[model samples]
Target: MSTPTLPCPGCPGRRNHGQYLCRTCWRSLPADTRGRLTRRDKRAVLRLQQLQQALAARTPLQIIRVSP
Candidate 1:
């Protein structure tokens, strides 16, 4: 029978510990520092795309609302 494998990738040059890691470093990152995209960033990109789409459709609307 095969043994139950853990998440710890015990590979050479790998860092981290625990079954979810290797055998060196650990996952000690902030909840928000995990390259999480901000809502404002998403909104800005979406707004830009909407603008481009409207321009392509030749029906652009001028609407700007400041968010607190």
Candidate 2:
């Protein structure tokens, strides 16, 4: 079985199911931001919200930051 892919919220690329961003966009995110987003704690949802807000505001991926 293969994972279903959908359009990435961050860019025009496609991302696999259960992933937040496509490979290109994911790799473009800062290491700290990626780490925070990958964490599955209570604050994980908040971190995802922060990422979405940044993307909506057209913030650059390199400088995007989420609360840790």
Candidate 3:
């Protein structure tokens, strides 16, 4: 099974625990998160995309396994 998403800006943090953060970054989020996306975070997201694209570029596109 996969981890649930961290809390989103969808509602208040006190209501639901962090079930809206992207699964990969769940550990980075706080239990009581600040909903606003800060400037550094925006830049970091761009950097994350660049890092993802860089990693993805070297991999073959075709898949070998199927999920049920």
Q: Per-residue lDDT of 35-54 in model 3, one digit per residue for the tens?
A: 22222454555543433453
Provide the clashing-pair count of each candidate structure. 3, 0, 8
Off by over 4 Å in 2: 1-4
For the record, the alpha-carbon RMSD of candidate 1 to the native fold, in angstroms, is: 16.9
For model 3 the local lDDT of residue 6 reads 44
Q: What lDDT tens digits, residue by residue, belong to model 1 across residues 1-68? A: 33434543322344332223232312332224212212357455554454345435644122221121
Best of the candidates, TM-score: 2
User: Model 2 compared with the native: what TM-score?
Assistant: 0.92
lDDT per residue as tens, model 2, 1-68: 45647999889878898899988999999999999999999999999999999999999999999999
TM-score of each: 0.28, 0.92, 0.26
On lDDT, the candidate that comes out on top is 2
Show the lowest summed lDDT stretch of 10 residues, model 3. 59-68
Residue 25's C-alpha lDDT in candidate 2?
A: 95
